[model samples]
Target: MGDLSGRTALVTGASRGIGRAIAERLAADGARVAVHYGGNEAAAKETVAAIGEERAFAVRADLSTPDAVDTLFARLDEEFDGLDILVNNAAIATSSDFENTTSEEFERIFTVNVQAPFFITQRALSRLRDGGRIVNISSGVTRIAMPEIITYSMTKGALDTFSRTLAQQLGPRGITVNTVAPGIIDTDVNASWLRGNPEAEAAAAARAALGRVGRPEDVADVVAFIASDDARWITADWIDVTGGSDL
Candidate 1:
């Protein structure tokens, strides 16, 4: 049996990109995973198919709405008796820089990225089993200066703080809360600017000490370890999966 055999995990935004990778990895580790998506039902189905129908199912919720947490957990309740892992990997980013970022854009980003995860966790506490794992997907932008995505970085920073504080509170219940921050991952989200553009990709790769761009699996592998029993003693820490970026 795998390290996470018989466990149940909820990976938000698992329809694509890093979230999809994490969902697949967790399923490979023998955890039945709830693949949560914002609106892409087709992509969610693909994720489930990749993980095997028996081991994965898709749940949809537009996290920007106030009742999203309730909606998500209500569906989740129908599938699993309790949750062993909660990966808060759902988030959105805007291209607008600090000067061009309107108040509306800022609010929207914060609502989906920060508020959703906060309320989702609060509601999940009751369903989360003792000795459960909570992994939040943050970004290296929180540490590196990226003014173009300042608002996005701010949301991740808040998430990091949440992980640390929540870890202390949940320790009594044997729940471990930690954040994984990724850098320069080559996913569809970055395809528009980094995929075909060799110069941009080269620049990004050079920033990392490893001299290569990161992949979704790079982050997923770290998350799988963090979610496993081996990481029970590790909590409230920001583990960087950045390929030694800016080091």
Candidate 2:
């Protein structure tokens, strides 16, 4: 059996991008996964099809909504007897001057990026076995301190802090919590504009000392290992999985 054989995992924002990649990797490693999406049901089903019905399940919930958060875990409770891992990967970006940003925008981003994960972890902790794992998908933009992406980076920075404190809290129970920060990943989030845009692509690629943009699998590999027994002793660690990106 693989390291994750027979394990049950829930991955948020799993319709595509890094979240989808994480779901596929865990499934390939033998874990039965619950692929969660906010609104893109079709894309979510596509992910399930790729994983096969036997190894993958699909669930929908807007992470920013309180009711959705509640319903999501309730469904988890109904469908599975236990959960072994959680990959909190759902988030959104709002670009604007600090003064122009709306209160609603702040709430929207924070609710999904920080609040949902907070409550989800709270609600799902009991179902997680003692040896369970939690990996929060954070970003490296906080280090670069980009002005345009300030709010998004702030949310991720909060996630890093959450991983630290939560790991310590869950450590006694043998559940390891950690954060994986990825740099510029080449994904569909901005596929329409980013592709063939030489100036933008080159700018992003230049950030990495490795001199290349990242792939979703790059971050997924880090998450997979963190959820394995090999990382049992690793907790409260905020790991930078960036491709040597500019800091």
Candidate 3:
């Protein structure tokens, strides 16, 4: 754990999955975490309870709406004196190929996955303390093509570019910006098809050199490192947390 006793962090989509793990890890490291959730207030409260209510709080805002994204930060401003870490982990995935995808589906995914983060970071800059950190959650789909999730891959590709450019822009402010890309993970997102089905799970695991699907904690640990002082010199890079998948 890094020395983050006095730091304050906002973790979007922190009510479940990788986001939940990241929020919990940050709190465990001593940073007061703001667990943001779009609709699951109960789940968000559960995360706060796990972190200790005194050290964590839950905030709600629909990231798909631009106005709601603004409202999220406004609420954060009221609770925190200043922001030290911003984790843009909230995203929506669409399982559709070129022929099957619809315009509305693509727009919805991009709105939440790409547009929200861009605006959130822009608004957060004024409140972000110098020497702070920004971590964006990306995916391995950008590197290994998955036609079923083509739109999802495109959103992450745009996010990767955002991270690199933001790192350059924030360098003068002493803030480090980076992206963490994860491969197949045994999260709720894949539980339907990746769990229970031993054959399917095995095939997914075989894609990684480690011969296993990842856990939320696996990616969370990497985010923790990037947010620490040890990674002060590392910025504008994609930290692949894929267990060497497709490599």
Quantify all predictions' global Cα lDDT against the true fold. 0.94, 0.88, 0.93
Q: What TM-score quantifies how close candidate 1 is to the native fold? A: 0.98
What value of lDDT does candidate 1 attain over all alpha carbons? Answer: 0.94
Cα lDDT of candidate 2 equals: 0.88
Q: Which has the greatest lDDT?
A: 1
Residue 195 of model 2 has an lDDT of 77
lDDT of 3 by residue, 132-221 (tens): 999999999999989888999999999999999999999998999999999998988888998999999999999999999999999999
* Regions of model 3 farther than 4 Å from truth: none
Residue 233 accuracy (lDDT) in model 2: 91
Model 1, 1-247: lDDT tens digits are 1489999999999999999999999999999999999999999999999899999999999999888988899899999999999999999955488889999989999999999999999988899999999999999988899898899999999999999999999999999999999998998898999999999999999999999999999999999999998898999999998999998
Q: Indicate the worst ten consecutive residues by lDDT in candidate 2.
A: 93-102
Q: Write the per-residue lDDT of candidate 2 for residues 1-247, one digit (tens) a residue.
A: 1479989999999999999999999999999999999999999999999999999989999887769878798778877899999999988854566767788888788898889888888888988999899999988876777777777888999999999999888888899999998888889986766778998889878888888888999999989999999888999887887788875
Worst 10 residues of 3 by lDDT: 64-73
> What TM-score does candidate 3 get on C-alpha atoms?
0.98
